[model samples]
Every structure is written in C-alpha cells, then in structure tokens.
Target: MPHPTGPRVRLRAGTRLRTTLALVLLAATLTVGAVGVVGVVATTSTAAEAPRTWVVDAVDDTSGNRWDSVDTGTSVVTIRVGDTVEWQFDRATQGHDLVSLAPSQPWETVWPTALQEYRDAGGPSVTYTFDQPGTYRYECSLHGPLMTGTIVVVPADSTNQPPTADPVVEPLTGPAPLVVHATANASDPDGDEVVVAWELGTGGAPTYTDHTMVEYTTPGTYVVRLRVSDSRGGLHVEEFPVTVTGTGGPGTDPPTDGALPAIDALAAPAQGTAPLAVAFSTQVTTRGEVHPYSVGLDDYPSIAGEAVLVRSRGRTHTTLSVTGTKPSARHGSVHVHEQACDDELGGAHFRLDTTQPFAEPNEIWPLFTSDASGASGLVEVTKAVRAGPQAVSVVVHDPDNAARRIGCADLAPGTADLTYSWAFGDGTTATGADPDHTYATPGTYTATVTVAHASGEHAGHATVSDAVTVVVGAAATSTPSPTPVPVVDGTPPRISRVGPVRTVRTSRPVVTARVRDAASVVSKKAIVIRVDGRRATKVRWDRARGIVRWRPAKALAPGRHVVRLVATDAAGNRAARRWRFVVRLR
Candidate 1:
C-alpha cells in the first residue's frame, strides 16, 4: 500500500551498505551465496599442521567503558598461511556484516576494495583462508570503526606462535559492589613462554599478573583487557566485559530516572465509536546518559519538548504534534518500540505481524523536526488498547544517519483515552480526533475513520472504524502526452537499370540507371554515378524521366569494368545499382 499524497515516515536503517553486496561477491573469496551449513570449526584446506581454525565470535554488548557496536572478538588475530578464520554470527543480536577494508585509505575510499559479508544469526559460518601471507584489515561494513579489527597472516612454519588469550570471569552481570575474579588462560602453540598484563579498561595502569580480583563499587559497565606478549615481539589482546548494577543510586538511574514529568490523553471518544480519534501526549528530554550505545557521546544536544501522537485506524493515520527537536527544521525517524530504554536500539520496532516484511504499515512511526530549539520530540500512532505495553518507548534517529540512535523516551502508560486515524481517500491521511485537510482536485472520494479507546473503560480493548462517501465539485483538466514521429517507409528513390551481357568492341563502355520514387520526386543533383570505382567525369542525365549515364574517363584497357548508380530522396533514403562489362582488344 502506497500513499501518493499521504504523509509517510522515512524509516531508514541508514545502512545502505547492503547495496555493496555485488561488489563483495565479485572481489571476495567467501561471501553471501549458496546458503548452507558448515561446522562451528571448519578448515578451508589441510596440509602440514592440520591448519588450526581460529574462532572469532560476535561480541554485541556495551559493557566496555567504550561502546564498540558489534565486534569480532580479539582486536587482532595472528594466523599462518592456509589456516582458516571463522566468523560466528549466532551472537549478533542486530544485523552485522564483515567487510575487508583498505587500511591505508581514508574513510571516503570505501566499498570498491572493501570485503562484503552478510550473515544473520543461525544462517551459516563465514570463513576464509589466507593463501597469501600478509597483513589484512577487516571491519563491519555497517558499524565501521565501532566494529573493526585486524588479521595478520604469516608464512606457515615453526614460527613463534602468538599466545591465544581468553578471559574467564566469575560473573558477567550482577549488583553493585560486586567482586569479580578473572583469569586469562593463555598459551602459545609453539610451546613458548608468554607474559600477561591486565588493565581495568575503565582507566589506570596495567597490572602484571595471570589472575586478579577487582572490586566494583557502582552500577554501570566495565571491560578488562588482557594482553599476552610472546618473546618474539608478537602480541594479541582480548577483552572481557562486566556489568555492575547499583542499589537504585545515581549510578543506576542518572537521567531523569527513566520517567516523563507530564503525560496526557488529548482525545476522548465515546465507546462503540468504530473509528476512534486519540492523541497520546507527553514531555520528552534528550539526555546523553539515557542512550549510551550511541556511536558518539554528543550525538544529540540536550533539549526538551512536548511529544504528542495521534492515531486513526488500520493503516496508521499518524500525526506527531511534538516538533522542534533541534535548533533548525530537519526530519528524523521516530519509532515506537516494545522495550524500555535499557535494551540496545530499544529492543526492536514494535510490530503487529512480527514476521517477514517490516515497515510503515506494519509498525508505528512518529516523525519529529526541530522547530527552532535544538531538542526533544515524540510521535503519534494507532493501535489496539492492548498495544500499551508494546508501544513503550519512542526512539529518535539521527537526521543524517538513521542507524545511529540519538535519543529515547519511555512513554508512561494509560496516557491517552482514545486514538484516531482518518483516510481522506485521495491517498492522503490525517490523525487525531479533530483533523482538517484541504483537497486540491475535484473528485468523489471515500473518507474513512478508525478509533480506539486507550484507557479507562476500555483499557487494552479492541478498535472500531467507519467509512463515508465524499465528493468535491470543482473542475480540473489534464493534458495528454505527445505522439511520436512516423517513419517514411519506401520513400527513397530506387535506381533501376537493365543490361545485357556483352563484350565491348570498343575500349570505353557506358552504363546507365534510372531513379524513380512513387512516394516522392527525385532530383538530378541527388543522383551519383561511378565508373571503374571512380566518379564518372563525362556523364549524361535526364531530369524529367530521372535517368543517368556514365562512362570511364579513359579508354578501357582491363578485361572487365564496373559502373555504379545511386539515387537519394528528400527523406534521407538511398538506393544503388551496379553492372559490369568486359573490354577485349581485337
């Protein structure tokens, strides 16, 4: 369903990187194609050392002091030629892709040389062999810097193997003041001794040790790093993420305590009204602390505004009254999600079908723009009364990059009494109990309304909708498309001549052809005659009957000679004829 004239939200994931899949298939060794199942640990080929397989898991948590979107564990992996590197996709909660990058090149130089990879959870295992020995850089095509790493491939030999590092932490998540014991099980494949050092990742100097205990005093997130260095100057780093919860202190809820100061239902349509009109209104504030997973710290400036959502029936006839999210007039995506502000990307878009296709008609999208002040906004939507929990929070996306979420607001429940949606029939729509629209063209249209009670007598109840016939009496006109030009078939003059096979008694031979066209008249200037592959100097022509005669410039000394005639008409069409005569010396 498309609305040619209706207001629609631009739901852009902002990751247009999927289009580069073609480039990935062309230059990549293993990418998306012929889907199948492979072992969790598989080798491309076997030779001397059985080609050990390195498992690089998908790390998608923001427990680290710094948020790196979806990363392939181990910032750097050292491998030998012919060995396999397997990228696991089971842990990627959100869509993540692996793409090769040109490390020396700048950001603008992406795609043509970038490796393209697409693998969803439970799809398949992605792996590639390093047939060539060198350093190769790769990163997530969508997340870029936030999810990047390096791969070092050397000649396969009894080289000093880099120590493999994996951190074992007691608890990954728990309450505040939690004491955590961590150990790095590291060993070199070449049986070489390695040294280990631990850094709290939050800040401070590295502590030299094999295992240590750290005390967590606040509720937040932390990451501990363990770098194991081999005596051969080869080192690899591994990170361990930990979550620290507070006892309802400042560390737990720093930004407004995840609450909206004011919430109101601006509409109240009576029960039994099929098409109900309602608007859920509330105040939203953008706090950097609210959304931590954002790529940048200051993606959204601090601002506040009242957000209102108006909804009608089946198709969301949505109207967002809350505007002025920023200092200037610009648009961004605002979607109603099912979870709280705690989940990544607000869990997911609150959808009704919860299946294959997901977009506009399937989900509720509220749009907002900065009126003048550079701050907050909200969206309006239409759903059943039971949609209260599903429509918990509103997520605002960056105006320039829709994938980077800038702000999130948890909507207080039971705020709106009735919601409304209206279809003006001319492919246009309106939301809110009282909506006004102006039609430009004169035509009969079927206007419709869908309404639902949000709270009170019908909390989490069903919805009703009604339609009515509408007619506009004004006159309108339209111009038809222009016709194409026709071709002049068989209009060019034809060169016709009749000749008998004869041995020329004389050295010079003459040839002639006539030019005639029933559709058009032919002119003498349009006729050309040639003798022996050269233009005939002594030529005879008849204008009235359209005839031409041509002879060689000199006496014919060859065994055979050819004479040609061509005639052309005003329609840019031409015709030609050729004849040959034999010249013999007596």
Candidate 2:
C-alpha cells in the first residue's frame, strides 16, 4: 500500500489539526466504552424502534447541517454494504456529493475519487462496500462550510451493538399544529430493524403502515401524536399540541365583510376616431373603504377617473368611471383592477373588457354601447318583432367578470328591459322584439339603425351602417323543343369533328362536331360516345343552346381517331353518328 513517508508534510495548524482529528476519528471504533452507552434498555412496545425515512435533503448542503438530515448537524444512520445512501435535494441550494478520503486506504479512496461523476447526477446516493473496514469523510462541493458528514464503516464483527434510541418529544401548543412532516429518530440497541408508525389513540388502535405525513386544509385545533417501534414490536410515543390560523375559507354568503365598488357602462363615440367609455360598476361593504381601480387596453393604461363612496341605508357602494382613447387593435380583452377592500386587508380583484368588430349570421349586425342587466356588454343584432324590411336590435349588459353579479350594478337587476332596433338596407321593412333583419333584394347594401331607450335620453343612430349581402337562389331556364325531321330511309348518322377544340385543358375544353341524325332527327336524353371502342366519361350538356361536350376518359394519342355518337330523346327515336378526325394532344 502507498504510504506518506516524506518530510513531515506540514499543513496549516487549523487544516492539519482538523485533518488529524478526522483521520483518527475515522480509524476509531464506535464500539468503544461510553458513559451514555450504559443502562440503555430495549423495549418491544410496538412503537419504540420503527424505521423512519427522511428524503435525503440536499438543503443540508448549505444549511450548515450535516447529511441534510434535519435542521441539526448529527445524523444517525445504519446500513449494510451495497446499501444506498439517499440524498434528497429538497430545497437544498447547494449541489453536493459524497467522497471517502483517507490516507493509505485505496478502496476507501476508490469511491470518493469517482464521487465527482456521481455528484453531477444527484440521487438518494450511491452504494458502497465494507470490504475494507475504515471510516469515510465527505463534504458538499457547492457549499463546503455548510455541508459535511461522516460514516463509520464497521465490520460484521463489532462487539458493541447499536445503542438504544431515546424517545425525543417536541412539544407544541394546540390543535396539533399542522404536521407537515414527521419522522422517527429511534434506533435499535442490538442493531435490530426499526419500523415507525402512528398510534392514533389508546386501547391499541390499528396503526398506520405507510408513514405518510398528514395535513389540515382548514384552520383548527386537535390532539396529534407520533409512535415508533422496533423489529420486536418495542414502541415509544409522544404527543404534541399545535394551532393553525390564517386566511379564512372562500366566501359562502355574499361576503358580509369585504366588498369592492362598481362602475357604469359607456360606449365609444360615433366619430371614427374617439375614445371608448369605461363601463364598470362599484360597491362597498363598509364605509371609509376606498377601492382603487384602473382600466387599460392592449397593455396601455387608462385613467380610472375618481372613486366616490356613497352610503345606502346601512351599507356602502362606490362608483368608478374610466375611458379608453385610441383605436385598439380589433378584438382584445380590456383589463380592470379592484385596488383595495375595506374590511379585508388583502383586497380582491377582477377584469372588464369587450370584443371588436363583432359579427352575426344573416342580419344587420349592430354596434353596441351600453350596460344592461343580463346582457352585460355583449351586443348582438337579433330578429325583429314585426317583419317588413329586416330589423335588428343591439343589447348590451355589464361585463360580468368571474361570473359574479351580486349587488355590483343593477343593469336590469330584476329584468333587463332595455332594447334598441335598426333597419337593414332594401325597401322591405319589419319590426319585432328581437335584433335581426332580412334583405329584400340580392345585392350588397349599407343598412343602418337608430336605437332609442325607454329610460334616460339613451338615443343614438349608428350611421356607420352594417353591410348586407343578399344571395339569390338558383333558377332553371326554359328550353325550346326541337322540331323532329320526317324519316325517309333508316340510315345511321355520321358525326365528324369541325373547328379546332378550345384546348385539351379540363377547365376549358371545347370540341365541335357535325351530326347528321339518320332515320329521324331526335331531341335526346342519353348520348354514348366511344373513342377506339371505349365509352367517354363526364359528359356535359346545354339543352337550350343545343350544345353538348364529351370529356375523354383519357387523353388520346396525337393522331387520327374514329368516334361514334348515339342519342335517344324523350320520343321513341334513336340516332347514331359516326365520324373520324385528327386528334390533338397538349
């Protein structure tokens, strides 16, 4: 084995003393007699030596805590060779790993030398062997001062066994303060296995098998305790009190405590370039309660005007108003904020916005600008009550954010009765209870409406009328019947090509033909045209114009071809036309 035999390699006093102590401690055996190691009794009460596991916490690396155990430096551990040392990186700010550095100890150094590679791939920890007996020293690479741990690798023949673990109780107040975490610090004196569990109550109630920590979702108080056991059922238990208090639960009945104010609805002006009205409602649960609010468009801030507090009988309500100047990019959400609350220190919040260039299916869509009950700020052009020319109505409601519409603003508190109408283009007119319209002619025309409200001088004309495009249904034209020629001798007719075809392209292919209907000239239904004895597919017809076309099954060879045409009209007459012509291919 390699040995350190040169001149007394003197290290700094601090470094040398620390290194000497570490080496001596590593060589020292834990089996040595100790005053505290006496009179320790082993019990089998089913709760004394339960095995408890802590996620190898990585936080111990920088917390000045060894082995990332708890908030403490000393860590108690026991395992056989090849056993894993799990290091949990739970909230640990430093990245660290284990290394075994000891003079003249090759095997011990083997694991630590390769620790760098393993440290990169953090995990519970790497396994090691006890083949060569000795001690191990390791430290965190990221934060050296904060992280350090030692392991005493004992052979299978140690005389002094593990010491009996003392029961440690951490006292608390009441309601069993939330037990976010729980672990057993007990161990077996005989190196026996430990199994940890919780003893719910007396009379030996069934204990929990998996040691999962429990938590409370609500604020409360309770009696909570922990129990530990050894392999032989020896047990130990401790009870502690805890209390929980914080933000209350979700509001159930119209928060009698904290309430925000409301705002009114305003519409953008008719001018193409004008600001939009900030339509928000307000409310307050208590007086002297000032709630700050602001509005904005597309990330641009808008003045939220001023907040006015008012008293209603015994309660309180505030009104907020704001406006948006500038033509916003079509279709976007407006943001509204509820600054603070009276009763609740943590003020609540919400948003208010509108859509741009809204459209409707088949009607004179309206330009909406108002705040009404049930409608919010959603504007639509619906069908009218009476029908003459097309009629449309535009309805707006409070922009109900969060689907919450309590005592915010009574747009139409009970029933939203506010409605307006508009007339579509075309002389045809109609009136109804809905906001919809229909056109009389099939043309693109500008339709306009003048809306008048029942309450207040809420009247406005949408001169920038919506466009209406009416479509006419397809109609069939009349066809003149061809007079049939008298038959003399029954002879098959011949069909020959005349003028050049428009082109070989499918979009526009035109071929002319001369047809001499043999026996009797007949107006026909079915026509069969064959190219080289094969029938053509996808034939088109224009009965009134006496024009018919036969798109070839496939492009013909650039040569001459023989073609045949046969037809049978409604009458019991048939004709066959056969001809030959030079074929063209492109």
Candidate 3:
C-alpha cells in the first residue's frame, strides 16, 4: 500500500518531464544539422551553377531588335552545375547571321538557308563552352560590330533540372513557291547529337516529317512547328508563322512574223543605166534597226552594152557608185543579171536593156555588134585588082552581122577579059552582066562591083571600087628615008613614039610627033601621026625580027582610047606613020 501511492505518482510525473526534455533536445539538434547541410550545399552549388553564358545579339520582326545595347548586357538563364552554352544569331535577311567572338566556342552560323544560298551569302561565326561561372560576349555574325549580349545562370536546388528551352523558330520570308531550309544547332551538356523534326502548316494546312528542308508548292500563310530533341531525350518545340509570296524570273526573245515582218532594204537602186554613174540604195519597212544583208545587180544584159562588177560595202548601208561603161546592152531577150544579196547565190535577178545606138558600118569599116553570130570579126582591106587569068571575090554583109566574101568572078586577058567582071560585092552573088568588052583605047578605069547576100539586094550589099589605069602608047615612030632630005653625013636624034604616046581619057584620037637631031633633024623631022594628040616615039629597024614595035611607058584612063606612031631616023631622015590600037584598062 505505501509503494502504490508513491510509485505511481512519482513515476508518472517524472516520466512525463524527462520524455518532454529529451524530445525538445532531439528536435533542436536535427534542425541545426539540416541548416548546416543546406548552407554548405547552397554555397557550393551557387558557385557551381553560375552558367558560362555567351550573349548573342538577337533581332525581332519589327524594324530590327538587338539582345543588348551595351558592351555587357543581361539575359536570365538557368543551367546545370556544369553546362556549356554558345549564343549566336538566329534570324537574318540580306546577309545577316550569328557568331560568338570568344575563342574555343561551340556554335556558329551564316544566314542558314540552302547550302548553295548560304555559300553565296558568306558569313562565318564563333562559339564557347561554360566550365566555370562567367558572362560571355556574342553577336550577330553580320552585324557583330553593332550587337552585344550576356547570359546569367543560378544555383541548383532540390528541383535542380533546367527547363527545356523551346526550339528557335525562324520563319524564312521570301518569294514563293516557298522553299525553306534550316540547320539545327541544338546541343546537350551530355555530349549527344541533336535530332530535329518539323510539323509544317498547322490548322490542317500541311505537315512535314523529320526532314531539314520543307517546300510549300502552293501559295498560303502557314504556321510551322519545329520539334527539336537532344541526346538526353530533352525535347523543345517552336511555332513559326510564314507567308508565301509568288512571282518569278525575267523574259526574252523577239517577235514573230505576224508582227509585221521586217522588210529588209535593198542594196542597190532599182533603175540604173549602163555607161552611167549609178548609185545603189535601198530601204526596209521596219525602223532603222540594222540587220545583216547582201546586195547584187542582175548583169545579164546591160542597157548600155557594158560589163559590170558588184562590190561589197563594209556597212549595212553603203553608197555604191559604179561606172557601166564596159558592159553590153540588152540586145536580145531580157538578160537577167544578179548583183548582190544577203547570200552568195540565188539573189534577185534584174534586167537592164542597155539599148545603145547601132553601129554604122561606113564610119567603122567592120561594124562589130558584139552580138554577132560569127566566131571572129570580118576582115577588111582597100580593094583587090588582077591582071591576066584571075578569080575575084567581093565582100559584103553576111547573116552573122559581119563583112565577108560574097561574090566570085573569073576572067581571061582575051576579048572575054577586056571589061573586068564584077564579082558582085557579096558572097553567093554575081551581077553586072555587062562584062568582057575591049576598050577602044588603053587606059585605067575604076571597075565597081556591088555584091549582095541572101538577106536582100541592097540590105547586105557591098561596094568595091578599084583604080584602073591602062597602058596605051603609040607604036614606035618609024622614021622613013626622010624623003632623002639631003643632010650632013651625021646621024640625027629621032623621036620615039613622041615620048611614049601620052594618051587622054577619051575616044580614039589623032597624034603628032617631033624629033631632035644632031645635024638639024628638027627641020628635016616630019610630023608623025598624032596619037592621042601627042608626039609619038620614033622607032628604028630591028635586026632580029626585021621589024620595029612601039611600046608606051605609062597608062591612061580607059575609055575609047587610041595611040599613033611617028619617028625621025638618023642622017636627018624623017618618016611619019600612024597605027591604031585599042588599050583596055580592066
């Protein structure tokens, strides 16, 4: 009984007090230890969680925007205790891009587009990694001189994992059919390759898979979503709105024939005469714009009967001055000649009737019309004459427009040859039937012969005249015994046919003679027959034939001509005798 009261009360009270004190001490100690651990971790992690961040200058859609305006600008960032970061440009136009100025950097870019386009718009960038805590410098690759930025990281806590950053969405804007290409610079502190997938055009517009490039063949505005995944399985998604515009490149070619095909100008004048100074010229339908062309002249037969040569002009338009003296006129059908054209062959043909005056044969003996049919020109001379047995050919016009032998004649010196036979002036012809007639006197006469061809009697007729002088002299004057007219024993000079019986161009006439003597034979000399009214020559006896023949030196014009002989012998002996004879001049 004594213990029950004492044990119960004392025991219960003492147990409660000790239990309270022990509980308080234990709580205080645990609180103090936890505080110390947290402080130490905060200090260590704060020092470690300071992320190495590079400030990349960034621009926005409006006019332009930059990450910082100062050398050291601020950007709030959170990363793991030991993570590296490289900040660079994310958007651009006309040659803008991103770069990190610091050495040992990681990310860099030019205006990231198609590789080909990128190469064309050159820009290279820089990169860096964060091992310890510090702010880093970065800028736009294109506008680095104007851009500056920085980044800051805080300490890690119970919730130490950093929030996944959205993938950078840069909607490329340009002319369409829209084509876009991009490069992923996503990196992980865990050292892993980045994988990027794209879901294009939200709102049922279009969708794309994991390709790096996307094309919108159609025209429209679209919201593009890009999902980027890192090696650590961290994923970031971003949406970009793009507008596709449409246009194209430039057009070239000329018009077709329908638009009034150009009419090229000619190179030479339309009408030009030969032996004339002709200037060549032409005009085209189109405006003065120049084109290649050639020129020519049709030279078949010139109007002036001349030869012409075409020449080349250095320019499209040229002054062509030519002398048409050597070319021939168009005598027959239209003779077409081609002068020049753009090409060498088959140019336009033209006809020039170079109709010059016909050639006159009398003026120019052998009137040569180049268009003559003969192989060669006709030959011409004065006129021919023949003596004894002879054949004569007379010249006249032929069908070939040439002078040629047309008539022929044959004659003998007998009564049949007294009058010269005319071989009519043309070949294939014979005329003047009054042929072969002896002249009463010996003299020269022009025997004219006119010849004609088959063309016409007078059309192709030719005239030929010859100077015919005849030899008619009185017979040698025969001196008689001088009637024994006593004279000195000296021989006297005698006249012989009175100086060869000079004859006149007339009928048979009388003749007289005179002789000179050493012993005054002139007084004893008697008058011999006056042959052709002139003194006759004296002829002495010839011992060989016992006869004396009279001969005249020169000839006279033929007609009814005659001659007589009278002579004085030696010893003053004179005798006069007259002989009649007819001389023919053929």
Candidate 4:
C-alpha cells in the first residue's frame, strides 16, 4: 500500500528473493533425480496483470498552457491504482519539471524533491504509477502557477472483477432549459448482473437506470454521474460534464446585493395619432432582490409621459398608461424606435428634426428599462410627429446595464383615413370617399380613382361596367345628332431594337431591348426578361430611354438559348416577344 498523498515506490525484482526461489526449485529437482530413473516433470503458472497508461504533454504554445494532457487536452484525469502516468516534454526552448505539492502548500516547497524530474527537448519521459486513492496535484516548477494538473486515483479491487462503464451525453453545451440525453454502456467481466444508476448535479434523488434524460433550467456547469455495480461488490463510476449558458432562467447565479431584475415581456402600440393614450404592459422576474422600479415614456427625470415606481418580485406584471401631446408644428416626421440594452444604461435618442433639440420633452416614446427577464411598456402620442412613411421601431435595453442593447422591434404604420378622387374616361370627374355619377351619353369609358392618405397617395382603376353605357335611340333619323366616338386602345408596345439576337460565345453577353408604349409604361417593375426559360439576373430598366438590360449571373452553357421579354402599360395592356440565339464555347 502507498501513502494517500505520497508517491508510490516502484516495484522491482530483489536479488535475495530470486536466489531463494532458485534454490528451492533446484532442491526439488535433485530430490526427484535421486528417487529413481523415472522422469520428473516441472510446470509453472502465474497470474497476468498489466498497468493502465496515461500520457501528458508539455508544449510552449498559446493554444493551451504549458502542461496539457495529450489524450483529453484537459488538466484533469481519473485512473485506478496501479495505473501509470507519463509526462513528455516537447518544447525545445523551455525546460519543465513535474513536482507534487501538498494541499494549500506553497509552490516553492515541492515535497519529496527526489521524485521531481526535469525535462526538455530530447529529455527522457517520466513515468509514475499511483497506488493510493486520492487527488494528486502537480505543476511545472519552471512555469509556476501557469502550468498545473490534477490526477484522481481510485483503489484497485482485488476480490471481484470491476464493471466497465461507457458514458455518453449529447449537446454538452447550450442555453438554459437544455435537455440532455444520458446513456451508459456497461459490462461486468465476472458475468455478474450489473446495476446502473444516474445522478444529476443539480441535487435530486438518484435514478436507477442505464439510460435517463435530464434537463437543466439554469445556466452553469453541471456534473452528471453514471455508476455501475456488480452483486459481488465490484463497482465503476464515470462523469459527464454539461454546460448551460444564458442570461436568465433557472440555475443561474443567485441574487446578490446589487443584481438587477429580468424583464420577461413588453407590449405597446407602434404608431398613433395626436392625443395618443397608450396602455403599456410589462412583466419582469427578480433574483430574490427588492427592486422598486418605475415605468414611463423615458428614463428618469427626463420622462415625457408617466413613471410609476412599484415593488417587484421573482415574477412581476404591471401596466402603465403614458400620454403625450402632439407637436403643434410639423417640421418633419420622427419614428418611435426602441433600443434594447440589457447590459448598460445608454441608448440612441429619437430625433424628429435636426433643428429641434434632442430631449425627451420633444419626443414622447419611452426607453425601456433593462432586465434579463425582459421589460415592456406602451406610449401614446397625441399629435403626429411627421408624415409620409416614417420609420418606427421599438428598442430594448438591458435593465442592469443600460448601455447594452438586447432586442428591438420595427413598428408598422397605423391605419389612415383616406380621401378618394375619381376620373371617368368619359370626360367626367368626381371627388368623395364614395361618389355617385351618371353618364348621359357614353359608349365605353375607363374609370380611375386616386386615394390620398395622411402620409402618402395611391391610385387604381375601376373595372368596366355595363351601367355606364347609354343608348339614345337605336335607329338613326333624318336629322340625327352626331354620333359619339368611342375611345380605343389598339396599339401595343413595340420593341425598337434587340441585341445578341444572332450568336455569341461569351456566357455573360449583355441582352438589351428598347421598348416603348404609346400610353406609358406603368413602372420599371413591369418589365421582365428570361433566358432559356430561366429568369435573367440583374434585370434593369432605364426609364429615360425605355431600355431593359439583363445578363446571366452564370455563364450560359454551349447550346441554343431562348430569350423572352414581357412589358405592360398603364392601361393594363401587355406585350410579349421571344427570340433565340446560340452560345458557343470559347
């Protein structure tokens, strides 16, 4: 047996024991020879045993410290007694020595200095076999505390054969609320029935099974264990490491003196008109700390709306109503944006106009308080800031650290009250949300409507209807009035010129088409071109010249290619043309 914390003595053959064994064997052989002419037979049997080997390497690299295990690349190793551990030095410019130290002992006093071995490039490897069950701490004397390692030794069983356990865990690292599937492949050499058990590091009753699933609610490193045992008292244990990471949830750091609460959710409107009255709702979770906080349209003394401070708990829910008067003068429109900073207290300001000073009094929206649980609020602006498609967003910030931004939301425009203006192609016009007009004499006419919103304007055409037509006498008389001429659109858009219509070897040859419509092209988006049945890449339309240009993103294969062009006009009329050309390899 070896001392619990001391190095074990190496096993070596002794001269005295060998001589005594040889003499006993010789005496037995002589006695058999003297007995008679009968032949004497000699047989020998010995039990076979070998020590397990583990390796560590020392290298001078920033990837890892000087001393790292060659097998696992970590500083820790677990082994049974009678297992050999070897340390090899591979750095040519640095010399390192492995020295054992007592618990809480100074590094200058390495116990049993005779056992320490220094090595460098081409140096001999040092080997040691542990014979005691205890944690052994060692370090490189040259590198001081920078290089350190630990070895955990277990006592070897001499009675029944111990079982072997192979443990596996999937997705060892992830965010909180992590689910890990743990399984073990265990076997007993003595053919004895083995029992497997699992224990989670979070402190719960151990589970008896070969396979089990465990979930971690908090963020931290958890040690999961698998144990196997035989009826004859042989046992084996293996460890699985799991790491969970996140800002909040269970298993996170316990509440400290100044730790901030977490915000769970926030809700509010994105856009509203003047005299906006907003109901802001919020939910937060605290870390067992007393956090008397306020909710309002902005942070602290500069708040433009309302701020109500209330005591919060592990889970808190509150709603605050914030109202603001709309600016009388509209310089330009300003967006209500939310900037989230969970780590710090500073965020960007809402600027409605460059000439106006940046202050919460001018802007009505709130900057959310930072919290890991997440915080929410609502704000109502009584007046419109600016018009014409203003961009709005909600910015989220960390409660504890206001400078850190954690999340955001881009708000969509609110519904608008619209006014419609209509033009009947029969030379008649009307204005109203919904207008009623009668045609006196009409054969065919195109009706169009233009709608105006608070921010912008849009126009669309109405479907043709039979109610608009009037028949004034079916037959012509001797003194009949002049007949009305019906408006007609019979001309289609014409393609003035097209290129690459013959042949080309370059795969990326440019294809151009000059198109024009008598009425007018609806938009550049109305033009489309395809090559070989596939849409061409980078299709651009030059509105000034009515030219559409496109090229293949990839080189065209060597073959005949078909190009198609489609164009549409404001009258809802469309024109299409197709042509073919050959592509040759260069």
lDDT of 1 by residue, 470-491 (tens): 4454442286646758746666
Clashes of 1: 25
What lDDT does the true structure give each of the candidates? 0.48, 0.30, 0.27, 0.44
Best by TM-score: 1
Provide the TM-score for each candidate, comma-separated. Answer: 0.33, 0.18, 0.16, 0.26
Q: Compared with the true structure, what per-residue lDDT tens digits does model 4 show for residues 477-497? A: 488677779656656776645
Write candidate 3's Cα lDDT for 156-230 as tens digits. 232222123223334456655667764434444445555555556522433223445677654334445444445
Which has the higher TM-score value, candidate number 3 or candidate number 4?
4
Q: What ordering of candidates by lDDT runs from best to worst?
A: 1, 4, 2, 3
Q: What is the TM-score (0 to 1) of candidate 3? A: 0.16
Model 2 earns a TM-score of: 0.18
C-alpha-based local distance difference test score of model 3? 0.27
Best lDDT goes to which candidate? 1
lDDT of 2 by residue, 1-586 (tens): 1211111112222111101100111122111011122122231212222322222354432112334333222332332222223445444432334434343222222233333312322333333333323345455422222244444333333333332323332222223234444344556566677555553222144345434345544332223344444543233333332333332211111222222222111111111111211111111111121112222222223211112222211122222222222222221111111222212211111111001111121112222232221111222222321111101111111132211111121111111112323344456433322233433233443334322333333223211112222223223227764675864554544343332222221111223344433234445346676666887766554342233455443335666666676766544456676666554322
The candidate with the higher TM-score, 1 or 3, is 1
Off by over 4 Å in 3: 1-173, 181-195, 199-227, 231-243, 246-586
Candidate 3's clash total is 78
| Candidate achieving higher TM-score, 1 or 4 | 1
lDDT of 3 at 130: 28
